[model samples]
Target: MDLQLTGRRAVVTGGSRGIGYAVGRALAAEGAAVALVARNARHVEEQAARLSSETGARVIGVAADTGDDASVAALAEAAVRGLGGVDILVNNAARTNPGSIPDDDLEAEINVKVRGYLRCVRAFAPAMVERGWGRVINIGGLAARQSGSVTGSIRNVAVAAMTKNLADELGPSGVNVTVVHPGATRTETMLDVAGRRAAASGTSREEAERRMAASVSIGRLVEPEEVASVVAFLASPLSVAINGDAVIAGGGTKGPIYY
Candidate 1:
């Protein structure tokens, strides 16, 4: 499958590691030029260099905090200037701070996940609309559905609503917008979550990982590349008709229509 992505340009937030890096790599593999955005300059440069070397694709690194409007605006401008224009935008940056119930800051979480997404979309979608083609894939979470145990459930729920809203607004402009809910991915963040769960359960991290897997229908954690594959599909021409849909890439979520 060609994906018909050659010569296209994309910007992926949080592209230094984990799911964001995987999506960047996949897009580069499909022959799209990509600008990888992250707060850490060195990490973003390293990933961009690596992906460029591996796929022989044009990959640029831009350092910016997506949570800040100024930073996000600068990043979007840099991407457009570097790549000519963006045909795809992947909003993958997120933040989940850990603290006691009374100390947790839902506002900070929402600022990064929800506001950051909206800012990115606002900065980039106009270009896509003018071009009459775009792909906007929001990297959502399973917490959007199963909110009971998740600490950042509020942020995820807010993102779910925003995703639908953006999809509706952009769909009429030739931009296919969709959200992907990746469950329990094997990323650094997931490892941190597992560690916390282990300490709470009075068990080892290994045991907690096993328990987490068992909780899901599939007895394993989802790989970042697995979610990336879905992202690639959504960004490809094959998924032009999948707008406004929230697709779950979790290893078979616990409840029906988990999104």
Candidate 2:
């Protein structure tokens, strides 16, 4: 299906690696000019160049810390200068969990995922409203549905709420806002995690990955590219009917009837 993304310009935060990178790649391959944003300047730039070469899309890299207002403003400026203007914004930068104390991590995680997403929207969405076309896809996590990490659930739920609010506010102006929830997906980071788990448990890497996917009904971790495919659809003009919704791209959690 034609996603109608040609000539579209997109900004994807946390785009250097993992699901963010996959999203950027998918959009670019679908004919959108893309700006890949991340905190690390050199790394994101290198990845952007590689993506451009691979897909032959006009892709560039911009560096910014989403948690900081000035940095996000700078990112918006850079994206405008690089990609002309962003028609799609993907908010994917966030603090990883399972390490810090849930109580202590709440504020920090919210700062990055919740507030950071708002900053990007504030900096970029007005222009989208002006142009009368835009897509904002916030990358949330499944913790909002299932509960294990307090910080994860709170921050992700906040993103979902934010998506609904933004969608209502911008829907009339031709902008769509949505949130995506991904479960234990397979990305480069997950490969590292699986290797570590294998080393720690004296098991094969494949075995570690199987253990990781045991809770998923598909019996496998969702690939980053698979999640990217969902976001790419949401980022396109064809996704108008899906605004303000939470699309779960995790390989289906085992026993949750989320209807």
Candidate 3:
């Protein structure tokens, strides 16, 4: 199916690696001009170059701290200058689960995932609204649906709430806002995590990964590229009917039924 993404301009935060990188690659492969944003200048640049070379798309890297307001403002300007004008915004830069973190850590996590997402939207969505077309795909986690990490659940749920509100506000202007929930996704980072789990449990990496995949009905962890395909669709004009929705890109969760 043609996603109709060619010539679109996109900015993907946390685009240096993992799911963000995969999303950037997918969009680029589909013929979009992309700007990859992350906190690390070098990593984003390297990845951007690699992606451009691989996909033959115009891809640039911009470094910015999403947790800071000034940084996000600067990111907005830079992305506009780099991509000409942003048509798609992928909010994916966020802190991972910090198990047993102190209560004070809650503010920090919320700032990064929740507030950070808002900041980016505030900075970029106006242009989309003016153009009467845009896509905002917020990368949340399955923790919002299932309870495990308190911080994870709170932040992701907050993101889902923000997505709905933004969708309502922007839908009339042709901007679709949505959240994507990825569960136990397999990426380079996940491979390292699985290896560490294997070492800690005296098991092979494959065994550890299998155990991690047990909860997924697919009987395997969802790959980053798999999630990217879903995001690519959401980032395209073809996804107009899915605004303000939470699309679970995770290999179906085993038990609960979500309407």
* Candidates arranged by TM-score, highest first: 3, 2, 1
Per-candidate Cα lDDT values, in order, are: 0.87, 0.93, 0.93
Compared with the true structure, what per-residue lDDT tens digits does model 2 show for residues 12-74?
A: 999999999999999999999999999999999999999999999999999999999999989
Error of 1 at 83 (Å): 1.1
The sequence of per-residue lDDT tens digits that candidate 1 reaches over residues 207-246 is: 9888888867887899999999899989987898798878
What TM-score fits each model? 0.92, 0.97, 0.97
lDDT for position 150 in model 3? 79
- Estimate the overall C-alpha local distance difference test score of candidate 3: 0.93
